[model samples]
Target: MTDWKKIRAEFPALENWIFLNTATFGQLPKRATEAVACHFARRDRYACSDFMGWFEDADSVRATIARLIHAAADDIAFIPNACTGLSLMMGGMDWKPGDRIVTLEDEFPNHYYYPGYLAAQGVEFIETPFERFYDAINQRTRLVALSMVNYSTGFRPPLEEISGFLRERGVMLYLDGTQGLGALQLDISAIRPAMLSVDGYKWLLAPTGGGFIYVDSELRRHLRPNIIGWRSHRDWRNHENLHHGTPEFGTEAEKYEGGMLSFGPIYGMAASVEMMLEIGPEVIDERVMQLAGSVRDILRRAGGVLRADSDSLYISPVVTARFEEKDAGVLAHELKSRKVLVAARHGNLRVSPHFYNDETDLERFEAALKQVL
Candidate 1:
């Protein structure tokens, strides 16, 4: 059984407030914080020591992330944020005048605007209503990019079906998984998207600027390195060969990694990933879904209107509902005043519960809602 109480103890922030906003930013576990501090201390010990060990650390972190997504280690790369990954994907692809890309309207701006940036290369962007997003893809479409979960409403998309449909037409699929990665169990092997990017700050419970990108092995060759840095070469550490000819391009997804690695945040992310794996993704998924479902039930019984699909259990731990006669922003403030933390987005109260949150947390949240409503 998953011991959520033990897990909660690992996150010091949870002890103070009911942090139901894992969708916005997750609370870093104490272990990750300590790991970051340790890395900083190590750096202080040897200011100019060889950085090869840090590269190895980055490799190991990518390997762990590969296991989490069920992808080959060589197929993943470290990026500072999800936008960089999306930009690399969009910029690497060849585009022609009138070429169309399809995506949803309410997507996070980073995911939305990168395709529009591609539009400046003479590509056209088409936004379909999220409900009918699949219907908009056609022969003229070159790529389909979307968030796996709506950040605001917590709507989980049908990733498998969309991937299948896009694959049949030879259109690439890019998924932004920021809202769903750690909170949901997603098998990227089954989804088979061309590229999937996730930032660790949100559901992954790591510090900001720690994120990863996944590219299918076959698609790796099709992408050119968007940013050039000395570290992107295959033999980047050989400082003795300063006058050597241009270094050979990296053989795998390492080509996407540009510039010196950020060892501190990367180490922190590695610790967070290890902790999540120790708890088991399946167990975390089950516990979070159960708590979110219970919270949804409580809200519905209190006459709140649910904006997400009521029957779908695959939704993210984030749940949202609208009160009939109250301002969602005001209700959110009221909940916060009672030591409950939730976000108000798009006229609904966004309640996101993580693994550390327990039934008692839900009860406290419900009692606060009762008072607010």
Candidate 2:
């Protein structure tokens, strides 16, 4: 049996406030923080001397990430952020004048700007409503980018259904999995996308600048890393023979890895992912949904609108609620003043519960909500 109460205590922020902002940035537990601190301490003593050891640690993180999503470690590459990952996919592509890319208008800006920048190259960028995405795909469409779970409304799209539709037409699927990876249960085999990227700071509870990109085995043959660095080679010690003609890069996604990575963030990410694996995603999902369900019920009774259907399979760890007469911003401030934490997105308050949160946190949020409403 999992001792959830003990797990909740691991996050120091929960002692002071009701933390419902994992959608924005997840509060790091003590284990993650200590791992980062230890890395820094070790770095001070052994800088270049222990370089290979740190690289090994980063590789371990890649392996842990692969296990979390059921992908091969070779397919996963450590990226600086989700935008860099998205840019890699966009840059690797050979665009034509009439080629189209479909994406949602409400998606986070990272999904928009890179592909949006390609508009000057005569690539037709189609920004459509989430519901109309399927209809937007045509023969001209070559790539479709989407957020696995929308950052604003906590809306988890039907990736499996959309991928099925795209498969028949040979359109590629790219997903920003930042908001959904750690909080929700994900099986990449079932919801296969050509590429999936994550900025681990938000839901994965890792330090900033730690992220990974996963390229499907089929897609790997067609795409190459747009930028290459010294570490891109299989043998990093080859200083004499730099290049003869075309330099040989690693066959896997490791070819995209740039210069030295920040050891603190990489080790921190490894520790956090290992912790999540120990707890089990199924246990975390159950706890999160249980808390979110209670919040939805209480808010509904008090005359609030649920942004997501309670019975929907797409209902993720996030719950967005709009009070009838209360402004979302005002309510958010009121809740904060009452020592409860939430974020205002669109016209609703986004309540995102991580596995560490408990019923007491929900009760505090409810009491604060009643006062504000």
**Candidate 1 lDDT for residue 280:** 91
Per-residue alpha-carbon lDDT of model 1 for 65-103, expressed as tens digits?
988888888988888889888988988887899888988
Deviation of model 1 at 224, angstroms: 1.3
Residue-wise lDDT of candidate 2 within 90-195, one digit each (tens)?
A: 9988999999999987888887788778988999999998768889999999999999888887677888898899999999999999997887888888878999
Which 10-residue span in candidate 1 carries the lowest summed lDDT?
A: 307-316
Clashing pairs in 1: none
Q: Which stretches in model 1 have alpha-carbon errors above 4 Å?
A: 242-247, 309-314
Query: Candidate 1: TM-score?
Result: 0.95
Clashing pairs in 2: none
lDDT for predicted candidate 2 compared with the true structure: 0.83
Residue 352 lDDT in candidate 1: 87
What are the lDDT figures for the candidates, one per model?
0.83, 0.83
